[model samples]
Target chain A: MADEAGAAKERKILVAVDESEESMYALTWCLKNVSVSSNSKDTLILLYVMPPRTVYTALDGTGYLFSSDIMATMQKYSNDVADCVIEKSKRMCREQVQDVKVETIIEHGDPRDAICQVAEKLHVDMLVMGSHGYGLIKRAFLGSVSNHCAQNVKCPVLIVKRPKASSGSS
Target chain B: MADEAGAAKERKILVAVDESEESMYALTWCLKNVSVSSNSKDTLILLYVMPPRTVYTALDGTGYLFSSDIMATMQKYSNDVADCVIEKSKRMCREQVQDVKVETIIEHGDPRDAICQVAEKLHVDMLVMGSHGYGLIKRAFLGSVSNHCAQNVKCPVLIVKRPKASSGSS
Candidate 1:
């Protein structure tokens, strides 16, 4: 077919995942709805971005309430969350598309910037993410990460918003 | 093998096209980067939205600048542009993906609202569009059509941004 020549090149699709159900829904949606070519070498890279750890100073805004061990425990919990999210997302891909090549990536920073940076560094063909679906007031106070990456990422960005009716089912 | 069951249902992808080079580039990018499945019956709907015809009323904002003949001429020009854009886009799909089914839709209204409404009405699986890549000032001054659709559309929205480096090559 005419498209065979175009399918020779490998295409990488980066999907940003975290603890949110929205992100997982995005991964499922992509598996069901977006893949460049079945004959082509297509890879689904599951990306998990961890928020940067906050330092505890003597006069920190939180009153330096946490001791050294407490801070370490918090860091451990964050790592656990990231691991769980990645494992779940990988399992989903395996269940949905058996032959799809899958890879995992973990980054640290603000999600908005880290997502864009990793997508550029990896030179992905497209970036898939889920919108938190925040309302007007909540979105205003806590800016939407998907929106930020959509504006900044150099590659194509796919923002998947779970339908309101299906939100409860998921 | 596992995906065959999922591929039985038909998937519709809506790609919004216009006169802008960015939009054309987006169509090309989508053809190369995003398609649900090769075996599944997927339809690509090339939608060209005409900005709603302006009302030329006496004592209007333009100080009653247009006569009846002028208004009719302007309307004809708008229709011509829509036809030309759709033809160009159809040719592109034929060149790239010959076997894939393609459809065309011409809508009249503000693109932001019209795009969202059309995607919902068609029950498309995904909505593909090109990012105008407006700067902060320009985007603020004239709200982005892609951004609005991404926020409002029920289906996954793919906003393809033509890379700055390759913008000139195309």
Candidate 2:
């Protein structure tokens, strides 16, 4: 119980990734910034949400038709995406921060919902993500994943923008 | 110039939106929480960043072919996303607060980058977002966007978590 209590105080950092360049940049930044000391355990959690798949079976005016294999295929695809993100994260962690423990999670649901659920479950110290502006119409049409996460999570959220390589260029 | 200057100082609240349920919740929270006085100008800037098109373009042998059309399309999309976010923001502002001016901005770039840039340009007092935890593997893979922003940006960031719908759920 003492050991467990000690572990609870550890600083947990949660990161959201979509395999985008900005996401990659965010991952790299976390490794460099978070430090683990004897007193404080620093853990990093990487999360990827699989786009939810809903099936619509056709009815021949009488009853239900046949179910498709798309759901299975999508689950496999989601697992594959998680695997890829994990592999990359591991490699980067190994190269950047040697002492920190890294964890990976993959879920299927609304990206915002999944993220909030995970963050609460873990009770992390902070949540971090990368953002790119989405225009009004597209945002209305599609939705902003980061915005949802920011609004729902209780911890402090750090949003990293791609660093200007040069101030002169937009 | 006087009107523009007055507008700038009116305690602007910039809420980043991506049209997600969590973001909308944050928008609602912001509307309910932030106060506006007659002497103060409360402006809510709904910012959206369109993911860069170059990310999708095939690298091919040429290596990152930049197209003018794609840039234009991205800008248009960014504007649309901002517009959608602004509409919701305004509605909330109207319902929740008084004597407030709401504005929206859309940019084509990384979301994190766009947000920080706007915050600085507008000299906003604070930034509000949501936190979603990525699982262990992904956390290791992607790092944390909020952490990165906290380290880099000058303003204070507020990360909101979803409230438990019921006490039993907690």
Candidate 3:
């Protein structure tokens, strides 16, 4: 019982990663800033949510159907991207902190919903993610993922914005 | 110097508190989850932004000239609320964490801009705040402070949302 109680207190921080440098910056920032506890009990979970593949039918307005070969190629590209991102994040964590435990999770769905559901199911202590910092017009069209997650997640959500001035340099 | 470098590495977490229970809940959550480092060098700053008081004059629409005494009384009321909230937050922090360094600051301005400015000025490692979780109708009327800060603040911003299911019990 005591052990369970102790285990429950261990922090599980989930960082939502994508191909963007913004998300990578957020991951690096979280490692340096939040994962440095002396006890090192905090576990960093790198989560990559693959956007659902859109299926096209003959009835669609475009009147074109994607062949299985093309679909397979697209899926392969996505898988490669996810693998590349997770590997880079893992290496960054290794370089930034010692004895910091990192776990990677790849999920498929709309990222906004998937991230929130994973955080809830895992009972993560905090969720760290990056802001796309979309302009008013862009946000109106694309909607902000970090904003959506911040509103929906059960745990606290940290949105890290890559500073405009430092964007070129980074 | 080595000391300066060590101090620079120390995390400065800024929590924006108002009279709202949501803000208090964020403070409590941050204390338990974020400020548990064994080394205890992380400094927790409790910042309270008092909304700018509107000055009334005869030229203003629907203006009834307020006497000096009335203005003084209103000022006193605002001050009292700030003091009360700060006191409660201090007590909660004391009860929750051991040897955690805390400092308090009071500023007067629009909370959205004031919080961003303060967080930038302090070079805070992260900003911890509570989301009002306003619905579309309410949010359209009153812009979200957490959302604004999350977008504008240079450092990371953690917006804690009070779960609706637990609102009544809390």
Which of the numbered candidates is closest to the native, going by highest TM-score? 1
lDDT of 2 at A27: 64
lDDT of 3 by residue, B98-139 (tens): 788889999886778788998999988789998973234544
lDDT at A145, model 3: 82
lDDT of 1 by residue, B78-135 (tens): 8999999999999988877776689999998778888899999998888999888333
Best candidate, lDDT:
1
Q: In model 2, how large is the Cα lDDT of residue A23?
A: 66
Better of 2 and 3 by lDDT: 3
Residue pairs with backbone atoms closer than 3 Å in model 3 (clashes): none
DockQ per candidate, 2 decimals: 0.45, 0.10, 0.39
| Residue-wise C-alpha lDDT for candidate 1, range A39-66, written one tens digit per residue | 3477999999875664333324575678
The true-versus-predicted C-alpha distance at residue A94 of model 2, in Å, is 2.0
C-alpha lDDT of residue A155 in model 2 = 58
Question: What DockQ was computed for model 2?
Answer: 0.10
Predicted candidate 3 versus true structure: per-residue lDDT over A74-166, tens digit per residue: 789989999999999999888778888899999987777888999999988789998973234544665898888887887779887665665
Candidate 1 residues lying further than 4 Å off, grouped into runs, are A1-8, A55-63, A133-142, B1-8, B55-63, B133-142, B168-170
Kindly give the stretch of ten consecutive residues in candidate 2 chain B with the minimal lDDT sum: B1-10
Docking model 3 quality class: acceptable
Ten residues in a row with the worst lDDT in model 2 chain A? A1-10
